[model samples]
Target: MASQLNSGSDLGFEADLFKAADKLRGNLEPSEYKHVALGLIFLKYISEAFSAHYKKLGEEEYADQEDPEEYLAANVFWVPPEARWEHLQANAKRPQINFTDVNTGKERVGDIGNLIDNAMDSIERANAAVLKDVLPKEYGRPQLDKTMLGELIDLFSKVGMHSADGKSKDLLGRAYEYFISQFAGAEGRRGGEFFTPRSVVQTIVEMLEPHHGRVYDPACGSGGMFVQSERFIENHQGRRSDIAIYGQERNHTTWKLCKMNLAVRGIDADIKWNNEGSFLSDAFPTLKFDYAMANPPFNISDWWQPQLEGDVRWKYGQPPAGNANFAWLQHIIHHLAPRGTAGVVLANGSMSSQQSGEGDIRKAMIEGDVVDCMVALPGQLFYSTQIPACLWFLARDKSANGHRDRRGEILFIDARNLGHMVDRTRREFSTSDIATIANIYHCWRAKPDAGLGAYQDIPGFCKSATLEEVRKHGHVLTPGRYVGAEDAEDDGVPFAERFAALTATLEDQFNESDRLTALIREKLSMVRYDV
Candidate 1:
């Protein structure tokens, strides 16, 4: 649950820092304590950013340091002196302030908790448009340990090291993301409600390569998908402005976490939340995105309603009320632009289950040719469930839209044997493993110059099968059905040549069957006359 996190080169911190912070958590549940800890981290980042920008402006000739416009232009939150990190930390152990209750309208002596609460209020007031109702203001609650709150402030002081490294302000976000992962592990099943394993999100983002245009996630959880997508653009040296983010989370507290998570990283997104969820209440009903990436809850049974039976998003068919695997898939597919592509995570049963018309829906999608590729992942790759899962890559266009014309072929990758164990119960795909899987996909999509090399099947690892082949196997898209055993002999020959040989063998079998049927009828007629 802890890591040796070093920001830039000159500034670094050990895992002990997080352990110390966790110790201060004391009797508070992670669900409640996350806001307290994360809020302070957010406060630290903005305060430091504003103070640095403020000082730099003051040193410049004819510059106004007090103008909020200057800080807004620089993408830094303008923190009032009373709300600054130094001001809060200086008064962490004690406070001297007259506080008025917003609801009660009465004045009272304030403690350190009330001081911090007022600080959050001032920040939100100054940046009304962006930070409105976004920060947690429950620090004054009696259950919070005032002493422990002061200790947490001390623990997060190490976060200041990030500002010294001269890196992007997003380093704090990395630290924030790591802490969320730890909390997810500690909370077990309940944690899965808001968090997805990092490797899984990384692998999807790498494969999709969502560099530009509108990016979306309907079941966004804690907004990790959006964060990773933005990071992808940053890593590839692309323009961040070229990417616009949109998402929707159903859980209220989880949605708040998503907002703060983005705010710390300085990522602007349109993330919506509603109790009815994405299924019953569509937030972006008409907005088609260029790239959609999501890891929705696995095999949810209560997602359907009577109203959903006739919904237009169910283009393939109406999903049975008992399961919503296809519902999420169809919703994503419906929102894709003409050339948009998406990567979705779902339970392994989605590959071959015929129950409740699921098989018919699979056939419809295959016949329609929206399914671009399927990947079977190793078990324990998720923190939420251990049923095993697969990634479904859907594309609205399979023609040569910058890539080769792949209208009737689907790439199958059996990565079930790839990832290594990261802990006693969970497995993760290493950077090398992710690259191996993603690069093969790119190669299959484009020609030699487009990817690492011209696409070639790796026998046990990947295979590109035609529509006819899928039909032969009853439209089961499991990678295991196409990407043969890993132990299968490799002759260093290309897949097309082997496919041709297999086709000839299939034709011979059909011819022999016809001849035997005629012989049997002739023999049966002879016996009947004798009898």
Candidate 2:
């Protein structure tokens, strides 16, 4: 991991690179361009790994050990002869000639376009499961002009991107991830299709505190949850190696992105891919996870729920087929270990919607003492939808952490007003904001505080509500309704004096407006006389 994030400040490297690539975007949208950029990064990564192994083979000490096995032993995919970075760079200036290459046939090797397809085919054969659908072989399509292909290759070559050191710096990885976020932001609602806000991931990590355990994401998008879990371990002075990661992604392209993202961070994760999501396939049927987190698509309607009518995971109640919110909840509940805790993001309706037997599921979970904490998140936190989101913390046992018995009580945090806008359209919780929310949960869950902030509850901020109180509210989990309105300031001024001062200011403003009107009239009369 690079100690300093080059994407943060004065380093215009990523910005410049993205701008140049965007120029070449031409007729392709950001979503399509994402595949193009990620493929290049993956190509660069494998090529560098191959080059590194090849250099070692050239050394006399390891000359006998220089085989594909040597590279595979180190988790490096074998880059075939024609797919090497040097070979591609040599022909970057001319991306149209059908030069001969022994491996890819006497086909076009001079064109950067053909090289991309050849590389994709080679990688697909090398690692079928991980890279089969990840590489961009369609660059040779009629849409991409030869001149533009050459320009892109030239730009990438100039960035010192061909070397192992450059790829290993983790710079390219961050840049590529940054591009994902940028595209997500650019695409608006569709952005949520593949990306989750980083701050939300951090907040979940901070609260769940997945120090050492199996971390899983059922609807893993680009593996942000897994990456954040690794980051949490490192931040807590714990080794990421102590934790195991497992994930399942329905989208093939997104799954590839997740694999590449994890690979870039050097994190080993077992990611399963299938058209049917966890709902239909149930990848890890018998395995229980220590910590599970996910940001599932909000209000998913076409989840193929009819096929899973009597699923065993529905311990609470059968979720409404029209909405998959409760279904995802039950899935995580079923997958949790005896000592497991999970934090998930869902559409705000899950908190209070009583439609279609959802209220029954909520009541059952509450009665079972599984629902831990509920948080109301602010709007615009996601790129995919403007609908508000909330967080649900589910714990197998409240007594696991030696905290007070919170079975009868649930922590409701009204953080709907928290977070700052990152841009005009999207808002993300800052580091302090994340810490503040996490600290509140930690302090409340501690042996003593469990749900108090400082001394008194900040109005409209947070509150600890008992099961009876929750029942009084009819199982609705919206925090604002329970937390009440925020506190108002006491100016300490007398009512009469304050009223007089306000009246005087209004009178002065009125007099000034009248004088301006008279001056305008005099100016008009003078103009008429002159005419």
Name the top lDDT candidate.
1
Global fold similarity of model 1 (TM-score): 0.87
- lDDT by residue (1-531, candidate 2, tens digit) is 121222343355666777777798777787777777767766765676677667767775645443667766666777777677777777767636565543545654346776677777776776674565666677777776767666666666555433334334455655776777888887777766878888998999999989997998999989989888887887789997799999999988788788888876667889998999999998999999999999988888888556798889999999988899999999999999997899999887888778899999999999898999988888888889878788999999886455666778788888867899878988989889998888878777776544444423566788888899999978878777678843111132333677889999999999999999999999988874434
TM per prediction:
0.87, 0.83
List candidate 2 stretches off by more than 4 Å: 1-12, 49-60, 63-66, 97-110, 160-169, 402-404, 448-456, 486-531
Worst 10 residues of 2 by lDDT: 486-495
lDDT of each: 0.84, 0.78
Give Cα distance to truth, residue 317, candidate 1, Å: 0.4
The true-versus-predicted C-alpha distance at residue 522 of model 2, in Å, is: 55
Number of the top TM-score candidate: 1
Could you give the C-alpha RMSD of every candidate to the true structure, in order shown? Answer: 10.0, 10.1
